[model samples]
Target chain A: MVSLKQLDLTDLSVRQVNEYLHGELLEERPAGVEILNPDGLHSIAAGLDTEVEIDILGHAGYFIAGMNQRARVTIHGNVGWSVAENMMSGVVRVKGHASECAGASGHGGLLVIEGDASSRCGISLKGTEIVVGGSVGHFSAFMAQAGTLVVCGDAGPNLGDSLYEATIYVRGSIHSFGADAQEEEMQADDFEKVAELLSRAEMNYDAREFKRVSSARSLYHWNADAHQEY
Target chain B: MCGIVGLLARRSDYRDDLGKLVTPMLDCMATRGPDSAGLALFRSPLETTSRRFALYAANIEYDWQSLADRCQRELDTQASLTFVENHAALVSPVAVNTFKAWLKKTAPEVHLLSVGQSIEIYKDEGHPEEIARRFHFSEMAGTHAVGHTRMATESAVSPAHAHPFTAGEDFCLVHNGSLSNPYSVRRKLESLGIAFETDNDTEAGCRFLEWRMREGDTLETAIEVAQAELDGFYTFLMATADKMVLVRDAFACKPAVVAETDDYVAVSSEFRSLAHLPDIKHAHVYEPAPEQIYSWSV
Candidate 1:
């Protein structure tokens, strides 16, 4: 049986909570942790290196669980901007909507948003797999280098602008696709991959409705012949 | 970067604590904007059928009594004045335009912060908490209020450049994000005889709305027209005597969240700002769609 440690952020300052989470907790390596009454505090549980299970009871502010190496974090309420930003490994889940720049520039991780995410989700994602259950705001996956972004709902405008290499799956309507981003037919392998991602995120959604988007590869090298496309 | 917050109470019981509640919301977004702060409050109109103007002077010790006396003598009507810090609230039975003309001729240096039946605006170049303290915000009681904390990007930092720019009578606007083509817009409006106070981009947007409203367009129509005319990323919170409106650009780059309950409608740049509101845990919170105007009327 795993022991559970409890922490409350009602009175502690954001700096104090971040310091404790990044310093002592990383060294002690608690099996499970619960943060009660988060109340929209910022930078909570950021830069965690331990493989521990953590749960936040209330709303969290910006950069919650950012730069995680190995940690399974679950936020029971909504989150502010840049949740799970630049994660290396492990899973971060939000039961409610997440604000802008969620999972931005993450190299490796699984980010699951149970509700809608605001603008700039999964921007510059590298090897991270993000699953959003609801609609995403504009400028999502802008300049993404690599990885996969799966949206179960509608996607906002300018999706995947200036992409190098990334696989995007959307089950609903897309407002507009960004430059160099084109819709591709979802193959049998693509469906299997999306099914695995949804199963990993613990979300129940029909995989057949998903559409695949990838880079057109037209802007890979500048050519005067393709000037009209540019 | 800038932070904006607006709160309108549907119930009169929450009026007394409006300032106290909104001040904290403004203070929480201090990191987004640290240079200057401003607020516009709408209190219940006085029992008398008089128009009110809130005036601010750079020198805190400027004599406001003489101005009131001048207005009373020249306009042939009773004028009442009340002082709070460097601001004075004056009420007169004269029309707003006539009173404003008289004021411009008499006290050219005294700035009119706002002129309306119930609106009072106070702003200065400083931290939000300092500005709130200087204005004694805790003692104010109102039905609705809007505030802005500005981090100057294109304009110089001063009280005049601070936000909550008045458009017409009781209409004011607070903006986050920059306008791409304000100079061209300013030139067009200037050609139409719309006088401008500051070179700030937000002023151009406000004056555009004022011009549209003057041309018989409703606030909703003006906003829709603005969407087609204005370029750049912006989230605007506008307030009239009876309504509060919120609009975001089509790109939706700048953040805005709204929480509504049976008693109040609250808007802020982030959820952290609205976390402390009464009954927020059960409040219906959602982000407004891009380019869609969300409004509430009293």
Candidate 2:
């Protein structure tokens, strides 16, 4: 049987809970940590470097699971801004909607939002794999260096602005693309990648329905002849 | 950063518990803004001929009865006042111009917070929790209320600079982000011979909206104009006697979440502040989209 421990926030502050998560849990090695009554408090389960499965039972506040390492955390309710921001290597899944900047600046991780994600989702993303079951808001994947953002639903305006290397696959409509981001035909490898990510995210989208968006490479060089007119 | 919170109960059954329901929401947002706090409570409109004047003083022990007596003597009118700490709500049949002239001459030190048939404001410079307790926020009752906890970035940290900035009658506005074009907005309003009390950016937006309303533009129309004219980031929560309105900038650099149920509609800069509301578990919660105007009428 998996050892399950409950951390009820009614009697514990987030500081106390995090202290326990950071200190004793490493030694105790509980198989799972269940955080009860999160009630939209910020920074729950942040910086966890364990392989334990964590469950937050209520709506969580900003920066939850931020900078996560090895933990596989799941939030049962909605989350505030910057969820999983600056993550290293981990898997964080939000069952409900996420506020702005979800999975922002992550180095490595799989962040899944089953519901809609607000503006700037995966912003400045570096090598993170984000699969959204629902739509993504405006300016998503802006200035991304390297990653894969798969959207099963519509992509908002200015999607993947100033992109480099990172590939975006959208199964739904793209309202508009950013300056250097344009759509291309999905090849065999692209279908395989989208299928793998969708399977990991537990989404049911057919991989062939996805379209690829990548950099046009126009912004890579500075043009001295043009007088700043795009 | 600053915090903005507003609550409007849908049914009149919840009207008497408005303060109890909203005080904690205001207190929880102290993390976002801890320097000063203010609230504008909109009671049901009074059917009488008199208006209520919300007043504030720097010193908590200031003599309010003497000032009231002198006002009654000078204006030869009957007025009644209730004071708690440094704040008071005076009710009388006096015209706004007459009251302003009398206050300028007799009690220039006391600050006039708001004047309306329903709106009563209480604000001070301190920790929001302490100030909320001092003003007896939990005991007051109203149909709706708009509150703010301010962390001043572009202006002084004084009571006058605290949020829930009011202009004209029952209208008040609170902001979470800074405005970059306040000077130009202020310049245009000032050119029309309009006066200003503090050099706060939110006051500029508040006065501009009220001026537009006075010029026969509806509140929605005024906000549409503001969307075009106002620049910079903002998540503004505004209230009049019967309406609670919210809006965000086009970029939505700031954040606002709203929770609505059959009982009430609540708004905050973040969802954390609204965690403890009754029946919140089943409320339909969502973030207000960028550049959208959301209004709830009582």
Candidate 3:
């Protein structure tokens, strides 16, 4: 297993560090790579395709682990923009707050933000599972495709705008739905699924306390012509 | 700096009259970039091999002939020098590897932009349709093609500064946005004594592709590296002889949409350009993911 010491970044540029993490040291990163100072370095561990594990000690920057194929990245500090953006597969754990577009256009995999998540948290999420422990910013889950987003705290304005096929669950109040999304009663099966996902991420939560939100069956379906006004 | 459009036949499924089908599509992206325009077409009626290269310079200088000559000599085995012009050429029996190796040994400071099969470029400054008329871009045809419209930010306005910038024989690129940091990268490219033709970020992009390909990166990987390292907002498209690659910036500040059918795929800066397709009603249209790459093969 590749065991990168945190001190190894003394001389390497951000690109070099990413190249080493995603390119050369990927296969050997079974034991995981430990980053000492992950302070705002954009594109860290991006596009990784191995089953490697990366531990960032501090805040990270935009598009970190973008297009991730099969890597597990954990951030200890707050992350800037687009954490795990456009992820194809794999897992990303943000211990602190997350900025805008947290999982934008993700096709698959799971994202867990332990703290507050900013606006457009799961914008255009395509088959991704996102769980935010704290509140979220405006337009969260905008234009989401097919996936599941779970927010433990309050959601901001225009939640689930232009939502496609994704499902959302929130323990706190939502300002409003953007287009056709609406709140629904949580079912037994949905509670079970949410509980399982939260358990997998080891988050402290009870699925029973949350309500489910989803499309009103109005937009994007082949024959559904009824449009919902903002 | 430019807009690029192309047709990549899933199974050579584009219309029999490919040229006739491509002209109007290329004409749509005029506002994005409009400095100068050109088109390169290739066909394999019997057995044809194509190679595409996108080169980036480490630095901007007055001359690139030595680098070009080195490229010509290094890639002699794969290319027969079918045609030569100010920036690029058309070669028969395009050699992908030979060109790649030459890039590594010679233009290590440059970036290898792209590598693939058949390439056609339509570039100029003006509205897309206006540039098309000026270049007579409709005359060229291929199963796969890429076009660019320029809104110059860093480079001087000229055909040389235009998009669909070529690296070797068959690769070209069209870009939008600026590279925030060009000094260090340009210095490195010039360290190899590589000369540059234009003062545009797009040229730097071409050099970067060349540099990456030389480093043994696939055209796709090279372009990805460019997207990662280069700074600022970028929503650009690239075409090689064999494939088309698109990259959006970190936040995807710019807009790009992709419409795909079983038989066709179209990309544009806005959705309106795609609304004109015959199968537009049936195709699935979506915006490309930010900081992502979408590829199509010819």
Segments of candidate 3 deviating more than 4 angstroms: A1-230, B11-15, B34-42, B45-117, B120-122
Q: RMSD to the native, candidate 2?
A: 1.3
Single out the weakest 10-residue window by summed lDDT for candidate 1 chain B: B43-52
Best by DockQ: 2
RMSD of 1: 1.7
Global fold similarity of model 2 (TM-score): 0.98
lDDT by residue (tens digit), candidate 3, A13-62: 77887777766684454477787655455688888888877888765656
Error of 2 at A100 (Å): 0.5
Which one is best on lDDT? 2
> Candidate 1, overall lDDT?
0.89
Who wins the TM-score comparison? 2
lDDT of 2 at A13: 96
DockQ ranking, best first: 2, 1, 3
> Which residue pairs come into collision in candidate 1?
none
TM-score of each: 0.96, 0.98, 0.48
lDDT string for model 3 (B92-136, tens) is 354566566666787666544334454434343446676566545
For the predicted complex of model 3, DockQ is 0.02
The docking category that best describes candidate 3 is: incorrect
